[model samples]
Target: MPELKGVDGLSEPLLRLYSSLAGENPWVEFLTVLRRQLHASFATIILTPPTARTPAIVVTPGVPDFEIGAAVKHFSKDPFVGLPEGRVLTANEFVGREAYRQSCFYQQYVASYGIEDIMGLDLLAKSGFQMRMRICCGAGRSGFTEEDKQWLGYFVPHLRAALDLYERFEIEKGEENIYDTAVEQLSVGSILLDGSGAVIRCNLIARNLLEQRDGIRLVNNRLAFSDTANERSFRDFLRASGPALTSRISFMQAERHSGKPSLGIIARRLTMPPSLKLGFCPAIAVFITDPQQQAGVTGAAVANVLRLTPMEAEIAASLANGLSLLQISEVFGITQNTVRAHLRSVFSKVGVSRQSQLVQRVRTSVSGLIVQMSSGSGAPRRRSRQGAPLLHSAGAGQDRPQVKQTRRLSHVP
Candidate 1:
């Protein structure tokens, strides 16, 4: 890195350089200006090398991409590439001018376009980030001078920083999208509330639940329940000051239609570090679970981990959700004896001798956290021939067990 006399007249191009990170074509404006300032024929940059599914993204500012002929395309690798990092080297300087002129790579690819002089800046990051920029000129024009090299050299560090920041943001954004999609697949509605009880963030599931207005909704941007008593309790929870001594979990049911079950909500306060409390930090997170929509434990997921037949896996998953042996039989249209037989097999394979042990094992299994995305909402529910959810308790419409029977059936029986 060499020091310049001064960065006079660099404000405009430097501004464009950093600002380009947020633009659709990040390097177009800066590269276009670089070409103009240097009086070059073309300014090109390669961000991502070609892959099996995507062609290399090669950007040539002010130059429309047309066929450069088969000969040029066939010369895929640049012979003048691999220049010393951070050093601006022209093609003539990189290789002997005579050798550069005689090389088939230049004669076939570059000469066809009347390009005589070429200057390149390459960044090879240890983190596998690669960027290369080239400025080309015609034979009639003077080659890139020391001043031109120094000007580009000044931009090297800033270009690297801007590119690094851009890549970091893209990776984080991609991770966020993946997490949100997983939440949607699990069918859990999430809502975030700030310290003042204002809505900070709400996912699509939460939005749909609020839109229904069956039991709870957004009232002036704050959560509200249909029942006045329940509303007061929620308001109290929101207004409570100071952090809890220990992590705590609270549950509340928002009553829905007359015959329908209430929406189950689990509220937990988020404890932020003292340093992060300056901003509008989310103080509470509310998760809504609809048992009617709960298909989180799928048979395929269970079978993969438990190594059981699909039917046995389904029975295990049902029992894990607090289903009695009788209810499991009714759900699968199998006899109680057959259901108990499957339960015994599940216990044996799961290394559990008792029915309750098998239930707990399945409940805590990896399958419990997995969901089969069969349909739009990704919740694949089991329905009886009567078009009713087999897992739900009729009339009661609660998330509790369908029957009050004991979990254990003796092996002798």
Candidate 2:
């Protein structure tokens, strides 16, 4: 048999192992190499990203098969014995040494596996993240030498580069899958606008919500939000939320519905491909809420979002459609002061101060959701009319208030 030359010479064995480890995770190939080269009673490889403390094991192929690729989380937290200064551990340095002899938890396991020594090569990324890749040897009386250290030092860089490439590839793959899933699951109309505020990507929900507007369509590989006043504001918010800017901009409903607070949140960075960094002006991820999906929208579906007393939500819904306190009182058969008091409480509970404020707060709370109401259809569709002192209807039976239309954008991603 040809002698294995550290990691490089074991390529043939690794190819065979890769077939078995192949699954959702692609990091398994490197671990298979470590398993073949170590010739140990057991062996494994770990890859830990900077954002996480938990080390994800990529491969484990031998006697201690159960421990294969098991995440060595809480390694840093172990006060019993810090990792030895050197990469490799000889029988004397491990089984015969003070740290191993003194460690109650780790010693017994090493003995049971018949593992006499270990060599842990710290795989470091060009990104300056330290990763752990370890090999154990139980070959009787034979141990790792300085020659092995030199071989690992030469092989480490190649492993690091390969791992880095694989990770980036995996991230791109995962992001693509997630984006597709988001497109399928979300109910809110989403127009992925570019830096110029043109729509770059739109799903069925967005197409349905935006009424198939042409201005928002792609023109010469760019999307425009249909030069409207609201479109301008949406573009402005997107710019503020972009990575080039530092301002903490938020997206909220342009109008509030009755009894519900407008949904708004700060947009954060979305994951993108490395290719985009060179010249790709990526679209920002902004959330829009759909009121119909809200928990407090007067029905069981919205009971949670509004967090209102059932009676209070009813009153607020009445007030939202430009209803006067007297009209509401007549309809509910309550006094005007009592209705006003309830309105005040409704505003406070829903995080609004006045009727106009209440309406403003919920406009962005739910997207593509016109309050499931018939009364607002006749009221002049006044887009800019800020405040209309609610007029009371003459008869109690005829007093129905218009419904508020709040926009909701959900973060399905």
Candidate 3:
């Protein structure tokens, strides 16, 4: 541990700070710790400036959040705009003590939130990236003293380094996400099974398919089929035998009240390398592809692109699949009014005015690309939910020309 000589109660916060980059609510834990230590109203991060298209991302735990801290972005009249970069400054230091108290911004905006004083730092990275962090005092909390400023200064270098590391992580993660992005676009239902043939994880496509309760659905978190013989074979394939094997089941999941059941499924036993063999990892992957699903738009496809809520994405995808408003309502078991309301939200977010325009937007999206039918069962499958490599399906002796093993499972009563 580096010497935190001047700063008191900083060791815990700093530990949380560096560890929070990958967490769901990154930095919230650190901010909470720091807020208590500093005896402040809030420790907030202004992640981005609010824009016409999207709202600013604010992280101020235990507050109205975007309303108070994000006010820095919306409020036009701001006297604290020009803080020295990478340096901590108090509100009193920004403007004269008397001027800051008398400023219209404080009276009109700051006072309403019960915030009495603010110690802020603006960090600008080499990539022209910027974020502001403020340690604020509310009513009855004593204003920041000189010791506070000195203590905060101790964190600047560490914070900058953490931010740099965070940016690099995001870049690397973005590159890795291309595989998932492609799978989501293809809309292939993928499920991962363990050594005992129990479902461990599934992608959004699998979730949606399982929801339909078609020929292939989940039974107690494991893959299930309408025919007993197919189910037995699928279970057998999921069990790890001496040699890793792959199989394909055709029309295994027959859609009830549908024109034709053309779902093609591929199951492969996986072999983990000696290094990656740790833990109770998934041992099988079942890749399900429905021509009807792959040929049309799936809700999972556009969810990331539009940043749409799951419901909105579903509604949009349904519309893109040539389903009318009534059809969407009927399929989802919701009222037409509710369906229209969600459609309107989608329209607003996507900048479209009409249903036709919305459908056109979904159809034109890269996610709308049709996934072609693979030549046979041995064809590769896409990535599963946050998994190991899917393309590296070949087990031991991967370079050898293994015999083309195929199991064409047909539905038998």
Candidate 4:
């Protein structure tokens, strides 16, 4: 191998390629851009495992259309795949040393894959991470020059950023899809409202529920759920629950005009997943209403879902109904200071910031559990169902306190 020169000629195109990849999918754009710029026969993007032995091509496009999975499977045989993991196996080094290089892995697996000389860029994610990215460009009629490698290398970092964004977008999109499916499968009418109380998203059930009458029609920027005290309560709940740390509030009303007799409001805060705490995305507030089946988990049900102590569950249920600290304290016949202390413990155990966040988390978690149950995956859990006593001896609504018999319903004897 000769001494590699600086990337003087390729800098301009490389910069343009980088700019194009920003806020866009890298692999698709790379194949399209490289085909015209590098004039390559084929281009592929491969993801290599930590060991760098298995190069799974996540995306491939360009000339010499190949079997996507099989092409990547074959490339895993090449020892050069490990180069990104700090193992440098160059073409010059492998060609003369390894006899297998004589028969290209692609040729052995799929003849006429038409890969002659290849230029690759080794890409790794965050520092100290084990994943690798390989960009392979094959020579159709004529082989690649050293210049092609320098050009591709110049654009590799930009492509890597785009790939990372694309992967995240896909993940969030998939999660949203699952959420939508869950909402649709159930009889619950679910709606997710933004901080401003605008409907960001609502399922089919919510649509039918709200659109049946003109009472809750979507005006320019507001929702008119009802004309009486129900609308005012809904507004109050949304305002209080919008920024709650470990609490949520929700509203439900029977379609009186539609001949159903259900009307209620519940509010709770949403919890950010521990994994997503690294970013600054806003916490979500979920709203759901139903006339037939009551909305929200019963006190016993929520206690089971969160594995909360009976006292904690009572506090949570109170907060979920949009009760202030003073209100909750009065309701439970406890001092305000005691209510504050209990809430702190609730936030810590449930992993949320304020009351609103907690309520949102509880609703989302319970809804998810219900969805899983409907799919035959499992059942909703309650503290009482967890072989724990349902109530404390000192709290309101106390019962005769004997050692309650317990049974484990999760795994039967």
| Candidate number with greatest lDDT | 1
- Tens digits of per-residue lDDT, candidate 2, 1-413, equal 22554435655544544443324434345455555555545455555444334443334532243442222423543222334432444434544555654554344345555655666655555443345556666738366776665655555545656656644443444333323323333344444544444455655655553453332334454434444654576556655544455324445453332334443322323434457634445445444445554323232112223545656766765655456778878888989888878778878887887888765544333221222111112112111123311111111112122122111111000
TM-scores, one per candidate: 0.58, 0.40, 0.56, 0.52
lDDT score at residue 389, model 4, on the 0-100 scale: 21
Stretches of candidate 2 off by over 4 Å are 1-25, 62-98, 126-128, 187-413
The global C-alpha lDDT for each of the candidates, from Candidate 1 onward, is 0.65, 0.45, 0.63, 0.50
Please give, for residues 1-413, the per-residue lDDT of candidate 4 as tens digits: 22234342344445444554433444455455565566655455554322223332344443333344454445545544445432323343444323434556533642344445445555555421123433333434445565555555655556666545543443344334444434443356555554556666667766776677534556554566656766776667655632234444344553356556654434444555556534543233444455565454444445656767777877887677577888888888999998888888889999998888988877777677644532324342112323422222111123211111111110000
Count steric clashes of candidate 3.
Answer: 0
Candidate 1 has a TM-score of 0.58
Order candidates by lDDT, high to low.
1, 3, 4, 2
Q: Against the true structure, candidate 1 has what lDDT?
A: 0.65
Question: Which rank order by TM-score, best down to worst?
Answer: 1, 3, 4, 2
| Candidate 4 lDDT score relative to the true structure | 0.50
Steric clashes per prediction:
0, 30, 0, 40
Query: For candidate 3, lDDT tens digit of each residue in 1-413?
Result: 22354334778878889888776666678778777878887787654311112213456676543354345444456577568998889887888667876888777667777877888888865554456787878878667887888878888998888767755554444323433444556667767676777888877887897787777778787778866777776766655355324333333444443455656777655655456444566666677777776556666556645557789988998888788889899999999999989988998999999989998888766333322212122212233244321221112122211222111111100
